[model samples]
Target: MLITSGNSMIQSLADTAFAYGRREGDHDTSIPDLTLHIRNTPTEPLHCIYTLSLSLILQGSKQVAIDDRLRICSAGQSMLTTFDLPVISHVTEATRYHPFIGLVLKLDYGLIAQTCTELNLERPSKDLRYQAISTQDIDTGLCDAMSRLLGLHLTPEYIESLAQLYKKEIVIRLLHGSHGMHLRHLASVGSPSRQIVQIVAWMKQNFAQAIGINELADKAHMSASAFRQHFKALTGSSPLQYLKHLRLQEARDQMLLNGLDASQASGVVGYESPSQFSREYSRLFGLPPQKDIQRLRQA
Candidate 1:
């Protein structure tokens, strides 16, 4: 999405979500996509999910950390995560007074790919070095379309045919814009972005095993440094950082989805020192892993 469309979509969504509680520190509202509410706090250290359709920030500010790399996005800004990634997310500042709100748009690779072809966009190269970009760079045209879609969501009496057209139009702009390359990366396989995607596939398929950077690099047919550079460029994170995201999110999955305990789940996900894991978990997610799980359970 261009800067304009991106900003407008965020505003429109914020208006919709804001209509609900008036003030909510931490909340979730599921539309056709996901709306996340984050309150004023020190920030969170929870492991992140890389893939899934994501657009971030309706209000306030937060930072996303994967490995040692971090990116900050705030109100009027947005992020699109094309691949499934693991990282730590935090809401450094917000309040029921002004919460950190984010959106998650569901992804459909086939939809994006088919749209790209119709638009005459070029295919992305194998091995994407740079892909993820801030939505603040979006233009007004895209924003206007997205605002219309958001408006559609607000209008219950309307038919939904126009929403699909708006969606396709947004993808076309993304295709032609600087970040169009990122979407193309997903559609055309064997590109650098796609190569990292292949590695991501392996990690997901085998999250329990020890990872070798060289092997992952070889999977993409790039050397270690080259792979690291390109990987960071595309996803804004290093290989180890990417791996950790897989591990931590999986641990959360085991706890929330599979109903596992903290220590056991940590070990299962490849953490050797449980204490270290706890510390890192606390830092990344704010609360200790166990406490967070408990809170979720209580809720």
Candidate 2:
């Protein structure tokens, strides 16, 4: 008997994910392809870099603010992003009885390309409204495929073999969803969005180094002004601004996770002056580096 899509089934999947990885921080399970997220209470807005991924909200709701635009997504809705985005997200609704449960599957561009070839799917037209991050309703077919993917946890024997099949099906179902056009544009070779995606990937890796508009434009094969326009359109931030956020976030992680001091972290993240780093860190995080770290530790 196949697992069918229903409220009860979705709830059960959420429960399983929660049980498997119920920590204050993010949880990764034996399933290499997915990450299960559970938040027991409402949280302050968190700023992070969102990769090209699909996030399914199984049990609660959250609000995501990208640039100046805000979107609220609830249970049964999916948040799809085609490229890296800097976002501020908060879990607006959650409680012990009904905790916020979600699953994030990082989309594999290579696998998407393979599926596009196999299905003979043409690249869709670009929509200026598609800002890389968009929300869509979760269709019954997609929910069913995700249920089966989560169900693999119950049967260890088939997990290794059957997980791949369910993952492919989920991607195919996404191709048929409301954000299909944007997804197609992302997977399409030579599309402007795809070109920016490559540039973003490079920027992420070399964020600590100085990068210029002309260099990035050349990488995307676009004129300087056109590259800036397309980059902001797709990522909602100027290229240099995007790099700043990435560096700041990484510095925060260094301080919080790696136990680095402010000056050390600032130097490591490419700041020429520690004072400049402190000011910017305070601007973004609402406190000085040491104070923020202390607050987080106390919390």
Best by lDDT: 2
RMSD of each: 4.6, 2.6
lDDT of each: 0.67, 0.84
Candidate 1 segments exceeding 4 Å error: 1-13, 20-31, 34-42, 52-56, 123-129, 154-163, 185-189, 209-229, 232-241, 256-258, 267-299
- At residue 75, give the lDDT of candidate 1: 70
| Runs with alpha carbons beyond 4 Å of true place in candidate 2 | 1-6, 22-25
What local lDDT does model 1 show for residue 125?
A: 56
lDDT of 2 by residue, 95-183 (tens): 97778889998889888878887888877855446558888767778777877887787887998999888889988988877877788
